[model samples]
Target: MKLLAGLTILMIVFVVFGIHTQQQILGLASDMQEMVPNISREINNENWDAARNDTARLLEQWNEIQDRWDLFIVHSEIEQVELYIARILSYLSSEDKAAALAELAALNTQLSHIYRKEMFNVQNIF
Candidate 1:
């Protein structure tokens, strides 16, 4: 009876941790997604300075969250995001609108994929 109670408590704690992890991942992904469009618009308008600042801010935010993210997300996925951000920064520096936009799209897609993959759904269970 004591063993059974302990197991049940452990399961409850695991479930709570899983829910919190999912929420954090989703929230971070959503925040990053929201910034992408604004950066894209800045790029479209040829506002390089604003775009650069936004990209820097994005990188800063990523840096702040990445250690926590490393605990729950695959390292390769995290690395891919870092790579995309670096490429986007490079493109922005060169004033390459096409390339910058392309990278931003890729970054958005990656973030969407992360959240979708992390979602606690039937599809994910399989």
Candidate 2:
């Protein structure tokens, strides 16, 4: 009983220390899942190599996450994130990438503003 208690304590400690790291891993996995449809679009457009590369990157992170949680993530929001990544990665040149990234940053800023606004409204009600 004492040994079991000690193991449980250690497990809890490890989990507490690693939750953020695990979440980052999950975030990456979510990005990969989101990118799949964008990748399919690229494939349909006859960009096989680019599509395959994008798919591989996503699959690598996704498979790693699968090793952690059997279910992976069942959220539709993950698909949106992946699509965002794919849209940004579509740029072929470095300059294009920078422009794409800038646009993404702006989009994210807008999303955060909307989210915060909603959150504040919710909080004000209580």
- Leading candidate by lDDT: 1
Candidate 2 C-alpha lDDT tens digits along 48-94? 56755764576466446544443333344344444554565554333
CA lDDT for candidate 1: 0.97
Best by TM-score: 1
lDDT of each residue in 1-126, candidate 1, tens digit only: 999999999999999999999999999999999999999999999999999999999999999999999998999999999999999999999999999999999999999999999999999999
| C-alpha RMSD between model 2 and the true structure | 10.0
- Candidate lDDT values, in order: 0.97, 0.52
The collision pairs in model 2 are 34-82, 34-83, 35-82
List where candidate 1 sits over 4 angstroms from the true fold: none
What range of 10 consecutive residues in model 2 has the weakest lDDT sum?
Answer: 111-120
